[model samples]
Target: MILITGTAGFIGFHLSQRLLRDGEEVVGLDVINDYYDINVKYSRLAEAGIDKNEIEYGKLVQSTTQPGYRFIKLDLTDRESLNQLFEAEKFATVVNLAAQAGVRYSLINPQAYIDSNIIGFTNILEACRHHVVKHLAYASSSSVYGLNEKMPLSTGDNVDHPISLYAASKKSNELMAHTYSHLFGLATTGLRFFTVYGPWGRPDMALFLFTEAILKGEPIKVFNHGNMVRDFTYVDDIVEGIKRVIENPPKGNPEWTGESPDPSTSKAPYKVYNIGNNDPVTLMDFILAIEEELGQKAEKNMMDLQPGDVPATYADVQDLMDDLGYKPETHIRHGIRNFLDWYREYYGYVTDQGADAGAITDQKKQ
Candidate 1:
């Protein structure tokens, strides 16, 4: 069985469903912390057939809907419990996605980031080491490329100047994974995810926040005076890439040399890849897509760029395509439309005309 951490989270929930559909037995794990809205997290779990009322800390509950899936309420920092679960389950593959996940919030509570991202990740590594997992994949982030002005950021880029504590924590994860790979010969891969958005996305994300404010007729904050760009990848595409990576574990690069080392690969069984759309959409265009989907204009609250924010991010996904034969292709408009549809249905939202907003036809849908 595969062990997926942070299963109550956005990407993890979608990934769990996909894996279950593909006939993979999955054991989902999450602490169900109240970072954003616990309601959303619970709803995600409910969709996965894990009733919120049935969950108990440190207990495993089988899924009611998907027969191949089970869930456990656990935190990564609790090493003893995590180790016990790993020892009992003997998961062949592990994916670490549970982390205190906000760039801005990291500044407010740096300790939270260290606890979940650092201490927690250490516990995961130790558990995997003792459990003899074949492959381990963990979520890295585009924010790690702090202060990097290079367009189409590649995995080989030097990411030493991380600006936020959150980014620094992710960078630290890559390093820690490499150490385990080199020492214990644990196969590990780090995925640097770009701006991911789609149905059931985090409410703190740009798409969700923009949709919420516009639907409520409130002014939406446009940071950097709307001069920003993101390689906003769809959640489905991100999960697809992850699934591919999980199936194909990396081998040590024989070509790797110590004198001139490649940052993306190592002589050890470790690697990193940037998973993104490879298409940078300007912030204004992204907002326009949301507005078009909602058929409503947003009252823009022009604001200076907040701290721990990047002006632009474009991913060079050539390595991903060359190695995994996959790339994120979802357009912003299509993604926004999908998210808006989910938001409206989940929240019982209606247009000013007392009708549901019409769905936009996605000609690019494949």
Candidate 2:
């Protein structure tokens, strides 16, 4: 069976449903904490066909309908429950998507990062070490390349200096994984995800926020004077790439040398790859796409760059393309429209008051 953390999350929920549909047994886990609107998360669980009443914190719920899919309300930091689940499941593959996710939120609550991203991930590594899983694949962010102005960020680039606590925690996850791979010969792959957006996306993300603002006829805050760029990848493409990687597990690099080591791969069966659309879209274009989807014009309030926010992000996915023969092809315009449709239906929103400049400006101050 495959065990996936954060199965109630955007990526995790999609991945879990896909795997189950393919006749694979999947054990899914999530804390179901009130980070955003718990209703959206609940809707995701419902879409996955998991019964709400059956879910228990840190306890697995077997699928009555799908037969192959199961779920549990669980936190990564719960050591005792984590260990018990790992021992019982005997998962052949483990996907670690559970973590304290937002970059800005990390600044406000650094302890959350330390608990979920660092200490919590350490427990996953320890569990994998004892369980003998064939592969341990986890989510890493492009934010790890913080403060670097390098065009088209590559996996080979040095990520020693990270600007946000979120970025630093992700870098720490890599280090911790490498150590386990070296000692226990575990095959660990860290996927560095770019700006991912689509249907059922997180409410805190740019696309969701922009859609909400535009539909309400509110002028959205354009950060950094709208001078930012992101490789906005579609959720379907991301999941396709993930499934391919999971099928073809990485082997240790025998040619790896200590004197001149390659950062992307190691002799200890550890590797990192950037999974992205590889097409950087300007922030203005992104906003325009959202406006088109909502069939409304958005008022723009240009502003300076926010702390821990990068100006641009472009992923070099040549390695991913070569390894899995995967290429992300979904355009932002199409993806934005799809998301807006889901938003209108799911949120029951039918308004066109754009947020006053004063309200959003106050949000920025906080």
State which candidate has the highest lDDT.
1
lDDT of 1 by residue, 220-268 (tens): 9999999999999999999999999999999999999989888999999
**Candidate 2 local lDDT, 1-366, one digit each (tens):** 999998889999889988887889999888987777777777788777777787777667777678888898877888889889888889999999998899888889999899999999999998998988999999999999998788889998999888999999999999899989989998899989998899899999999888877766677889999999999999988888888888877888899998987888898889898989999999999988777766788999999998999899999999998888888989888888788877766655546234554454333222
Model 1: ten consecutive residues of lowest lDDT: 357-366
Scored against the true structure, residue 342 in model 2 reaches a CA lDDT of: 77
Candidate 2 lDDT at 149 equals 84
Best candidate, TM-score-wise? 1
C-alpha positional error of residue 113 in candidate 1 after TM-score superposition, expressed in Å: 0.2
Task: State how far residue 297 of model 1 sits from its true place (Å).
Answer: 0.4
**Which TM-score value belongs to model 2?**
0.94
